[model samples]
Target: MDSPNSARYSSRRSGETSRRHRWLGGCRDANPDNRSNVRASSQNIMSATLHTRESFDHSPVMAEEIVALFGEVPHGVVIDATLGGAGHTTRLLEAYPWMSVLGIDQDDMAIEHAAALRANSADIAQRLDVQRGRFDSIDTFLAQRNIDSISGALFDLGVSSPQLDMADRGFSYRQDGPLDMRMDTNAQLSAADVVTGYEVQQLTDVLRNNADERFAFRIAKAIVAARPIANTTQLAEIVANAIPAPARRTGGHPAKRTFQAIRIEVNKELDILPRALHDAIRATAPGGRVAVLSYHSGEDRIVKQAFRDAESNPLVQTVASPFQHHQSANKLVRKVKVAERPSAREIELNPRASSARLRVIEKVGS
Candidate 1:
């Protein structure tokens, strides 16, 4: 989830290295002896060492579910598309002795952190190979690696916990920082450019499309009026002040959606997501799986549509309109019915997991 970076909009879209070659370090197993433990059914599935955050302390959302989702795939290289802190990758490596992971992330911090993490264990260090780049560029990555396809891929979308916790990243509206929200620190576009550059309509569209901000127009207008908006706090204040008082009181923060919109614009998150998903689907071997853990409506809708598009023949979908529930019969991919919500206990333990939504599809044949 390349989101706002924290509990709210943890969606950060930054730019950096066109390619981060490898960050194959590891995490010390928190539960070394109990890596294979699993509780009852999926109701509250928990893996002893698998669910806890890595030494990096960033927990992966729906860890148990992620493992189970990929468990059925043909054992081979699985792509951890958003390898923030490598929590899910570590879990997957521990759970599936036969599997290796090709982790990908644009954030240098995540890649560096993962590199250092793998140093703790040679097992994962040997199995995990990380690359720094937008996940959507999967095609280029596979070509460079001399790999033809993958067994599975996982997309955990959003800004990472560390990104939000650190005020310098400018992802938290509650804190004051420079208006920078590029997931890749090296990326050219920054939140500052978006806040000060986009016109009212462009900005409004971004707000509406990225985060579905109801006060998109008002917020955009207010932002334009407050030209030299200084930093995150000021932007947050302006956004809050522009919203009707009643609406301000409900959402956790009036600026959450605004920040999300800006981050998405800065990173071009929505624009490239479809290509990324489709690329992953295309690169998947027969019986392989592609799983996504999106954090918001916009991300979810795109994931749903992409999966539907893969499942349905384009010619047949035109007729699907008359029958809204029309089921498409195809052989390329099939949905994996999964209960993806965070368990109440999981939410209680990590509130950031509240908005996580996981979707999975399996490649049926070539």
Candidate 2:
């Protein structure tokens, strides 16, 4: 999503034309018998380049469930609020041919990538509208587009795989890169700023609340001491060293939580999410649906509470009250049930999807 004050970054690369031709040539020369290896090679080549359309290689988490929930919405525009790699948007568009998608993303690279994908596919290109903005501004975007209400909305929260795998983006704890983790590259705050600028207590709260890091205090202190921390690797190493040895051995990576914490703070992810959810619910028409695919506990908690609050609409109370004697009132959407997580098989195929939790709610009354 485009930040309010930040300058937009150029999406074009100098050798993009040549690189595209090279990628196409590689595709054409691949042997059908060894297609799997060729596909992997192509992905690697794509990743090596700057932010090309193909570089955003991400598998949408719980794609089937997302489609099932949103596809049934009556013909109208569906908002893909996150639009990471356009994975969920493409699936929804394909499943419900009548439904168009408004794909919103903070990352300009994602918008460019979606446009390129749209260009290649005639049907999707005709129906997909790529917009550069954050989900929190969903209402304003729809208003500017002259759209009144939407059939469905989908929010697949958190960073995409390409964002993590691309070392330069600095979302990954494994790879060494610049300490930049802004989802909207144009955003002012970065991981480096949080690490170097935040006071020890503030940093500790960020780590503790964002990721529930047990050694938040120790990690925060270490980061402060290591003040001029340069890149992702340096911060990751400090976080790892600060944590107790036994604790570090069991978790996937010691720096994983800390990195997630910093990234969340830098992006202000949690703060805006509640507003975005409310905007989505308000924008959706009666009987329409809203689905959220969240990766972390904090995100899920926010989603859960928002849905619960919506379900207990004041209108319902007003309508039922004897004193009010209201015949009809606008009833908000109710949560279908608890959130759904990916199965073991899906997790095996795409480990990045392991933490995904999908919660769906549908508009109930006029």
Q: Pick the candidate with the highest TM-score.
A: 1
Q: Give, for candidate 2, the lowest lDDT window spanning 10 residues.
A: 1-10
lDDT of each: 0.72, 0.70
Which regions of candidate 2 are displaced past 4 Å?
1-57, 314-336
Tell me the tens digit of each residue's lDDT in model 2 across 1-366. 111111111122234344222121111111244334323313333232223333223346776567667645668999999986676676566556677899999987677767666656566577889899888999999999999989978898877655665678888778889999998988999988898999999999999999888899999999999989999889889999999999999757788888888888989999999999988888888767788877888888888888777767631111111112223333332223545777787667666666777777666554
* TM-score of candidate 2 relative to the true fold: 0.81
In terms of lDDT, the best-performing candidate is: 1
Q: What TM-scores do the predictions have?
A: 0.83, 0.81
RMSD of model 1 against the true structure: 7.2
